[model samples]
Target: MHSSPRSRRIDEHTIRSLPKAEVHVHLEGTFSLLDILTLAKDNGVRLPGPAATLFDITTHDAFTAPAVTSGGGAGAGAAGLSGFLRFLDWQCGLVRTPAQAARVAYAFAARQSASGVRYSDVIVNPTHWNAWHGRELALMDALASGFDEAEQDGLCAVSIAYSLLRSQSAADAEAVVTDLITRRPHRVVALSVDGDEKVTGRTGEKFRAAFARAAQGGLHRTVHAGESSGPEGVWDAVELLQAERIDHGVRAVEDPALLDRLVGGGISLGVCPRSNVTLGISPSWHEHPLRRLHEAGVLVTLNTDDPAPLGTTLEADWAVAAEQFGFDHADLVGFAARSIDASFADPDTKASLHTELASVAASAVDATTTA
Candidate 1:
């Protein structure tokens, strides 16, 4: 799986040029620091520090700073996944109006387009958005308006995956699903559940009915498991929640049986390497289970779980898979194809992305041979 230095450079170029889809990115965690600062000022929300110093909040240094494990207080010095979640709450709270929500959504699409991501399943959790709690449908409309505009302008096409926090009660989960089914908001394609699974403990039973409702109501289902929890959580996601895709399910490598299940069932894992490393989920890229899962025939798609806050991009993540994880050019291309396949996009869109990727991959091969 090792690539030569010259081949690595070519693979990087190929990765950058490939048409890709990100299946696990969160809208709340995708806000650029500049966007956060601008929204804060525009919405009359004060930052913990001066505007100039706020830029460091998403820098590499900030992740290693003292960990602020819970929400509340100033957000500038926060670190780790918990602190990142708190930052998402604070950042999301700044969108006091639908216009601001639309603006951020458009910015997300623009960012993805710049990274060569032609399509994306952007997760939007109403729980993190303190401002739009009661008016979640309105929030979805605002986000759809922005994404629709972005698509019309020839940016990336986006489908919203409305998320339920894992800490929510079954009733609460059902209520969210009910709203999704009843309102049928524009561009919402999936039902997702995310939060601190470690804090909430095992919640598969709690949300089972909700996920069933989502399935019956015609929404794709994705669950956050095996990052904070273990293989059992992934089992819950598969057996109980019946997840079509698992987000951060890197820990499934720990269980041979679970790996078999994943491989046999064809469930995709939206693996985010930098996010795992940044959050201390896998310690380092060298030790991350993504390679192991890939080797085991489990379908895996590379993603930037939280691009802006983690300070990485989708293309950079693909590069990491090649350089650090020992994936060759062909493997990188396979990853691109897997991303499109694992996405919630319609069959026609998936076919289009695959055809485009095949063309780029063929061009890369021709160039390499001629060189």
Candidate 2:
């Protein structure tokens, strides 16, 4: 063991795989190639592929045929796109029933366990399930069952959130919050506003309503802002939505005053750098806003918004931030702590996890020093 801070970090693996607490993974976005294929088959929904040629649901281009999806046959999606949107549509369809929701949740939880995620706040759109079951209560029941089952399997625990669509009208968005809160407040820990980042802002009244309901229901509020639009969107998400944390809030770096507000307000940022880069909202890893925000005393945490679609995971996402943002070990380790600090878990859980993280870091340092 080197017994020196400089030597410890340098000799360490370039990619640090510490125990992670993932707060931003969407259920729809967590579908593995096998999971999606299984769901598609079970739902009688035909996807574009054989097992080897599959794309995740959150794709930018249109669906390419199975052969074209893997770049085998004459690429159908060379310019325009075909069976891709079907997969996207079918992802929701597969979870229409309660049993299916439990299965997906369990599978997602199992995947997280393998990634060393000790705790996860998995985001799911109840509106998608609600629309199918004809009521919000049914969707909540299904999610509750899924979370309960995941708990039993040592995936630790899961807290659920209902995501409001940006494309929805103001009244419609309010209905989602109102219905979910009314039906199952305990099971639902947060309310998220997502979809187009362009849609995250400009809907001030809708945010206002959602925030009011979130506060009243004792649920935290968050929004997907700043990645697609400007820092102004971050402002709206924090102010209008009463966001405890802003998702993908890299654009806040462009506005110093907004950055000050974020620091002063004690709001956390749920940043997903790879997702931003892959979605074309960001230029590259080195350009991410996380390092500047962290240095400025703002509360920022790392996350993987869609892991598999971008062919990465929480570890890879953290490594990208570390490598490009010039973050050393403390910064990377702090990234994990920040997520734990911003979590919806109880004080006891937070305290215990914090100690666990510190212990893990200490062990790594000790091993290096003694070796």
Candidate 3:
């Protein structure tokens, strides 16, 4: 069943012009080497290694391990979870000031816009930012400043998903929920979990109270599951966390019942095809479960989980889904519609995006006919 790369090629122009929404991208993973270099110098933080060394795609290889967070266990070794944490720790160290945060946020917005992403639910795990240790609100405000500026300029509209890492204590998760509910930053939309699911295992039981608090406080919930573990991880997310959406729920393919539950519940899976392959969750795009999941009535949306660090873009991710899975323009539009429907953006924003997506699809069809 292996297909040649060229055999599945999608129309790059059509996909690029198709407006889409992304719901599973991380803010920290969007830092490019240039952004990292600038922030390191500005903050007086030593570079972990040279930019060339860190950003070299060939050096990392495609980690073929299932559900391993990009740095958690797949990076150059110290091997295992600690090494990945160290890698993420070093990256988060660079942005020492609010200005640096804004810079990175702006860059992320610009990059996403280039790939036709009109809206994004960007996950920002405060636990990752060692520099912002006691100043979480300040950090959120700074990132908001950047994203707001981007929005004003008609780039991608963005909302933040404040994440709680599974490695943290349940008390810590509760604390984050309290702060999020109290502060209720204008751009903050959802409560999410971002961490090495494999290392922490199914942790929904531990953070169940916190997620409950978030739900009561009117925050939407999503969790990273079924990436490093199995369908059990996803089941715990839905049953314990009451997750409305799942990040990387690709492994649900292994469980027929789980797949049924996801479809029945209408929980969307933000499948990052390239990120899954690069992180070794799936062997390659050709073999990815996205197509199968879509065919099975599971709502699937394409995205770049951490494009800068992973050397991918939303455009490339869409292309891979089309080329490898044989999704045509109409199918891509369906994916876009699903992403919009699943997003936590304001109702007005979602409505507008839905209309925009329809118009874009119709225009593409009309142009094709004219040609």
Task: Compose the digit string of candidate 2's lDDT tens values, residues 67-155.
Answer: 21110000112222123323444456676677877787788778777666777877775544433645556666676787788788666
Which order, best to worst by TM-score? 1, 3, 2
lDDT of 3 at 212: 98
Each prediction's Cα lDDT score?
0.83, 0.67, 0.81
Best by TM-score: 1
| TM-scores for the candidates | 0.92, 0.85, 0.91
Q: Residue-wise lDDT of candidate 3 within 263-327, one digit each (tens)?
A: 99999998888777766778877788887898899988887776776677887778777777777
RMSD of 2: 5.7
Candidate 3, superposed: residue stretches over 4 Å from native:
1-8, 57-84
| Comparison by lDDT, 2 against 3, better one | 3
Compared with the true structure, what per-residue lDDT tens digits does model 1 show for residues 164-216? 87777899899989998998999999998887777779999999999999999
